[model samples]
Target: MSSKLNIFEFSNPSIRTLHISWVAFFITFLVWFSHAPMLAFIKEAFDLSSQQIKALLILNVALTIPSRIVVGMLVDRFGPRIVFSALLFTGSFLCWGFAFATSYEMLALFRFLCGFVGAGFVIGIRLVGEWFPAKQVGVAEGIYGGWGNFGSAAGAMTLPTLALLFGGDDGWRYAIALTGAIAFVFSFIFYINARNTPKGSTYFKPKRSGGLEVTSKGDLYFYLAMNIPMYIALAVLAWKLSPENLGLLSELATNTLYVVLLVLFVFQTSQIWKVNKEHLQKGVAEIEKYKFKQVAILNWSYFVTFGSELAVVSMLPLFFMDTFELSAVTAGLLASGFAFMNLVARPSGGWLSDNLGRKKTLSVLIAGLSVGYLVLSQIDGLWFIPLAVVATMCCSFFVQAGEGAVFAMVPLVKRRMTGQVAGMAGAYGNVGGVTFLTVLSFVDASTFFMVIAGCAALCFILVQFLDEPSGQMAEVMADGSVELIDVA
Candidate 1:
């Protein structure tokens, strides 16, 4: 609970909890992304076409948008301990399946399934929020997020070396399978070691499940409206794979998906109304009511922050290679500075949020994010490579820190619903990624950066509406007692 505790002091249970949780998250990411660096080997082994390769890449992230939402609901109902373990355990098999696939169809299916592991990040957000007090939750969540996120970079760096070390046409399979093995072993370790909450602390649960609860009729409407984008992102992915685009999905299949999405949206709206209609009809007491607007704002903030990060990181190396006329290795190494900033920048953002006011910190970061991307939009062939890298790193720092700052306020919104809140926010991050990437496919690099900058600028305007967390959040215990959790 003390923000001042030495981070390495594992003697403290909370610190130990934070360490374990992040490691669980890290392994999930390692498994989730283990294929990225080994894609060349995979393509060679499967004799895949350029279109199939691109389809594989798109399929990789396709499931995570909905998976995060489902994982969030599950973690809220069943607790992070079991949910995280189950995700990693199942994902490990998917990893192995992808590793040893003899055909592109098998590879694509497994890779798509592996996207479920990305939801592991959301589970840890709730876990860290449970163990750490408000004074320290931001930094704890930041450390968890920042460190865990590095697993992708780690996989990218190490998987290729691992493949070569194995030395064969199937080397990539062995390398990827090793990542799955590690995830499988660690799943048991995480389940055995992690606790739902600190000793004797009540593990809060949502009063109902299926959809997020809303206090006001307007909020209910807002919650329903927000769900639309997630579905739209899925539809976009489907469209990208359809006959008109990459032709991965037939026209009939794509149309079926569209119809399915529409039906699901209607079903989900009904669920939302089912869960919240009684609460809205009776009116929520002010003490018991929390603003859905906070969740909405955080969703948009993450949409731009983490969303842009995803979009940029995907294209940055190519951007550097083309614009700077550098080799793939050098460009990739330089571009990695963007992701590498996560380690320090995210924690700094969270620490700033904890010490400074949350709204003020987010405002400054979002403003900087807008400016940073606007600067990036100007980079060109004539720009000095060092200066371009500096500009990229600057933008990355704001983008990642803004992610930290957004989640810093997530747990503060509603304690019992932290998983759902984090889930929706996390899903929006993917929505942002899908949206921005779809935009990128239609535009040039500078235009893409400008679009992201424009989105960030809009998010900056929205951040002004966010009410800072103060005093304490009230949650009811199972025994009909009120417990106040600090947010101030």
Candidate 2:
């Protein structure tokens, strides 16, 4: 630790890293989410069908599931500096391609690849963990995740105005391209300025690159079981695009995707074995290990928290317009409240986690989330607008706060594989979104919300199994000495 350090001091080395890391994360999010506010412009310009628009939304998140896992391995191996820079630069190119896309298919392809950039969130998880001490890591990570997440809201607020400033049907293209350009330039800037760790601190790597390393045979089984939802989500997306469903893809193409998914699953399963073979054959010393169950619990917790957030955000505008018979602009502005909470609620979640215990904080918030959703499900046209707004705000707090609480536990899972852990948990959040949205495709609006409430109830049960992180987790330094990283 540095002699000039005081945890209360905001200018400490750890806080500096938190500031820079979150800014980079914020930029990544702003670019990644730039499409939402401009969707009307895109739909009119491209003359896309409702199904095509849905597919495009799905495409935006399609590759993120596996991309997060791969990026996690790469970050744990090469360090965040190179990985974050490369992801931003490459994603910028994809964004540029999306902006210039002349056909729906081209736009879909580029957008899907752009999802890889979303993995940048996992990179900061590792970076923040490396810088912050255990006791404060909860608040530090909460601030990084909560504040950085505001980028989406920033994009929503600014990108449309920028497009109008250029003043034409093509203005949306230029506005979106501007985000890409910013990301590309910042990629190089971040590469030049950022260091993976403090001058003398060690950067740890995972024991293997292929999958998360587990300490126990039971955890290995649980880890394997937990991966099912991600694949299921992809398969559902494929089905949605298939000829039998939305007809966005021909039967041949849809069948091909199904085959590709199966092959990828087999390959991923093999890699999991490769990473854990030694531990499976002979377990490591108890002192050298951490349970994979913690990651599993977070995976489910995020599925409900972040997952429900994604689902609610996607549907709220439509729900408001349909339910209240409001104008499109009014519905949109009302819906924006769902996201606006990100600014305060997430930081509040972190503050709560800092003052309260992580597991306790999460349990309380998640319980509130379940009940909130249940209340939201009962709303009808008779409800006052102010009351509806209040309902949304209450539910939004638990959703965003639950998100803050989830990441509060991410860095504490495993010192060497923080990226991988965050990646998996984060990916599951998307899986939850897809699953919940798919349910919406069949159900009424109120029913859809009730379904989320049901899912939240299940997640609350899973949260109980998540152990409070304590003691020092062991990692090996480059000098062949053991280092103990505090988790409590």
Candidate 2, overall lDDT? 0.86
**lDDT tens digits, residue span 286-405, model 1:** 878999999999999999999998899999999999998999999999999999999988888899899898999999999999999899999999998899999999989999999999
Off by over 4 Å in 2: 1-11
Q: In angstroms, how far off is 485's CA in candidate 2?
A: 1.5
Candidate 2 C-alpha lDDT tens digits along 255-275? 899899889888988898888
Question: 242, model 1: CA deviation in Å?
Answer: 0.6
Candidates' lDDT values, in order? Answer: 0.91, 0.86
The best candidate in terms of TM-score: 1
